[model samples]
Target: MNNRLKSVISAAAIAVGLCFAPVQAADLPHVVILATGGTIAGTGATSTTTVGYTAAKLGVDKMIESVPELQKVAEVRGEQVAQIASESMTNEVWLKLAKRINQLLAQKDVDGIVVTHGTDTIEETAYFLDLVVKSKKPVVVVGSMRPSTAISADGPINLYNAVILAGSKEAVGKGVLVALNDQINAAREVTKSNTSTADTFRTPELGFLGYMQDNKAHFYRMSTRKNTADTEFDVSKLSSLPRVDIVYGYANMDRVAMDADIGAGAQGIVQAGVGDGSVAAQMMPAFRDARQKGVIVVRSSRVGNGIVARNGEANDDKEDFVVSDTLNAQKARILLMLALTKTHDTQAIQRMFYTY
Candidate 1:
C-alpha cells in the first residue's frame, strides 16, 4: 500500500469510529455535584461510632468516585464549595452556594444540580435554593446521618439517588428537593425532625413529594406553593441578605432575646411563639416596639406542623404583624428575609407568606 492510499483508509476508519462512539456528551445530561462539608463526607474513628466523628474529611472528587453507580444514570461533575460542618454555615456561604448554583444552571449544557450538605441545616439551604434558583432544572440537596466511614454509610446511596433525580426531566419545576432515606421532600415543607437519623428529614404538615422505590424516584405530588422559577428572589446580585433572627418562645420566656435581636439591627424577626402563635403578655410590648422600629415581626408556631392562622386572638390584626403560613420559625425567617428584600409593608409580607 502506498503512503497516500494508507492515509485514505485511515481517514475512513476514523470516521467509522466517531459514528460508533460509546457515549456522546450531548446525549447525556450534565449533572454537577456542589459538595459542602457534612456528615456525608465525615470520618469516624470507628465504624460503630456515628457521632463525635470528624466531618468534611473527604473532598468532592472522592465523594463522586466512591459512588460508581452515579455514572450509570448521569455524567457527574463535582466542585467542593465548602468543607465545614453545617453548624458553621453562614450567610456568606449561603450566598456563595446560591450564586454558584445560578451560574451553573444558567449554562445551556447543564441540566441539573445536586448539593451535598450537612443534615443539620440542609433544609435551610434547600429552601434558600428553592426560592433563589431561577431555573426549572432539578436541584436536589442530599445529606447523610452516618459518616462515610460508618458500617452502612448512607451517603453513597443517597448521592446516587440524588444524581438520578437531578438528571431526570420529571424532577424539573418541583422546587429544591431533599433526597435521603429514599424519600423526596420539597424544601418548604421538609424539616430536620430527628437529630441523628437517616429518616430525620420530614414534612409534618405536607407529606413528602414522593419516595425512592426500586432505586428510582417515584413522585406522587408536586408542590403548589410558589417556588423555583415562580419565585421573584434572585441571589445573583445579593451581596448580603438582610438580617433576620428567631426568638424561641417558652413558658417563662421574656423579651430578652427579642430585645437583643432588635438591638442588634434585625430587620425582621420571626417569633417562634407558643401554641396557636400567641405572644406572651410580657413579650407583646417589646414586639410592638420592634414593629415601631420598622422591624418586620412575623408570627410562627414553635410547635411543629400546622399553619399559624391569619388573624383572630393573636392581636395580629391590631398589632399589624405577619403570620407564617405553614412555615416554621427557621423557614419563616428565610421567607421574611426574602420578603423584606422586595417590600417592607406588613400586608405585602403577609401576602408573601400566603402565596409563597
Candidate 2:
C-alpha cells in the first residue's frame, strides 16, 4: 500500500481501539485512605518483634501496597496526612484532618474514607471525626496493636476490613467507625481496653456495632446519639480549638495540677474523678475559681466505664459545673473543647454534653 493509504488505515484502527477501550470501573467504591502515623504503619526489627518497634516509620503508599486484596475491595488511594504517634496527636492535626475529611466527603466522586491512626488515640480521633465530618458516607478509623512488620501483623487485615467497611452501603450514616480485630465499633463507644492484644478496642457497655464476618460487614446496632451531619460543629473556619485539660482525682489529691492548667489558659477542665466523678475537697476551691474565671468544668470518671451522672456524687448544680455523662475524661476534654467554641455557659455546655 502507498504511505498515505497506510497512514489513513492506522488512524482508523486507532479510533476503533479507542472506542473499544474499557470504561472506568464503576462497580467498586472509590475509598481514600488517609494515613496518620500509628502502629499500622510501624516497623519492627523482625517479623516476630511486635513491641519496641518504630511507629509511623512506613508511609501510606507502602501500607496500601502491602495489601493486594484491597484492590478487589475498593478503588483505593492513599494520602500521608501526618507521621506521628497517636499519643502525640495534637489539636492542630485534629482540625486539619476533620477539615480534609469534610472536604473530601462533600465531593461526589469520593465514596468513603479510612483513617490509619495510632491505637492509643484512635477512639479520640474517630469520635472527633464523627462529630465534625459533615457527610453520611462511611468514615472508618483503624489501627493495629502489632506493627506492620510483626509476626502475623494485623495491619493488613484491619486495613482490608476498614476499606471494606468504608465502601459498604450499610456503613453509611453509622457515624465514624473503628474497624479492628474483625469488628466494627462505633466511634463514641469504643475504647482501647487492653494494652497488648489484637482485640483491645471494645464497647464496654453498649457492645459492638457489627462485625466484619464472612469477609463482609454485618451491622446489628447503630449509635442513637447525634453525630456526623447531625452535629452543628464546623471546624473548617477555625485554626485552633479551645484548650481543655484533664485532672485525675485520687486520694489526697492537691490543686497544683488544677492551678497549673488554669494558669496555662485552659478554657475548660475535665476532672477524671473517683468512683462517680467526685472532686477532691482540696481541689474544689481551684475548680470553683476556674469556673469564676469563665472556665467550664466537666466531671468525668477514671473508672473507664459507667456514666458520670449529673448531681450523683458532686453537686454539679451548686458548683456551676457540667457533667460528662457517659463520656470518659479524654473524651470529655474533646467535647468540652468543641463546646467552648460555641458557648461558655455551663448550662449550654451541659446540654451539649448530653446531646453530643
State the weakest 10-residue window (summed lDDT) of model 1: 21-30
**Global lDDT scores for all candidate models:** 0.90, 0.92
Q: What is the lDDT of residue 138 in candidate 2?
A: 96
Cα lDDT of candidate 2 equals 0.92
Those runs of model 1 whose alpha carbons end farther than 4 Å from true positions after fitting are 1-26
Each prediction's TM-score versus the true structure: 0.92, 0.93
lDDT of 1 at 293: 90
TM-score of 2: 0.93
The residue-by-residue lDDT of candidate 1 on 39-131, one tens digit each, is 999999999989999988899999999988777678889999999999899888999999999899999889999999999999998998888
Q: Report the C-alpha lDDT of model 2 over 218-253, residue by residue, as the tens digit.
A: 999998999999998889899999999999989998
Q: Using lDDT, give the best candidate's number.
A: 2
